[model samples]
Target: MHTESQLARLHTADLLAQADAHRIAAAAKPPVELRTRVGWTLVELGLRLASAPGPVPATA
Candidate 1:
């Protein structure tokens, strides 16, 4: 099983990579501001998830 941080890191890396690709694609349109926002958002979420190093309490 993946530890939370490990899983989060994997997920964040994937998103950051996608964002970079999107940024590159935006080059086709000089004025277009296109970096996949979801990628950055996911990265933030992943970071938050990874910060806690221990079992999570179950929500009732």
Candidate 2:
């Protein structure tokens, strides 16, 4: 249970980090092509994180 909680927290942090990165990139006003690439990459990362398997059950 403890390990599962920790994993959850880590996943949450990862998501938050991704969000921050997206926000920073959006605000930087980079070239359209670069911005689009970054945006897609961030979106893909978020999707992968969201779809990732749940934490494994801790062994006794």
Candidate 3:
């Protein structure tokens, strides 16, 4: 069986690892403003596509 100290150390290590992982993940994501801009741009493009008129007829 493990000692109480060892268990405590293991728990601390696990918490530190989780914190490090979260930090790295947060760094890897785009900034909130940029993400919001891209999201709005995509929505505008989708709206324009949906409202597009049918293709024009070709002259003989």
Q: How much lDDT does each candidate structure score?
A: 0.86, 0.92, 0.96
Report the C-alpha displacement of residue 32, candidate 1, in angstroms.
8.1
Which sections of candidate 1 miss by over 4 Å?
A: 30-60
Per-candidate TM equals: 0.45, 0.45, 0.55
Q: Residue-wise lDDT of candidate 1 within 4-26, one digit each (tens)?
A: 99999999999999999998888
RMSD of each: 19.2, 20.2, 6.7
TM-score of 3: 0.55
Instruction: List model 2 lDDT by residue over 1-60, tens digit each.
Output: 569889999999999999999999899975669788899999999999999998999999
In candidate 2 the C-alpha lDDT for residue 37 amounts to 88
User: What lDDT score goes with residue 7 in model 2?
Assistant: 95
Residues 1-60, candidate 3, lDDT per residue (tens digit)? 999999999999999999999999999987889788999999999999989997989999
lDDT of 1: 0.86
- Candidate 1 deviation (Cα RMSD): 19.2
Candidates ranked by lDDT: 3, 2, 1
Among residues 3 or more apart in sequence or in different chains, the pairs in candidate 3 whose N, CA or C atoms overlap within 3 Å are none
Worst 10 residues of 3 by lDDT: 29-38
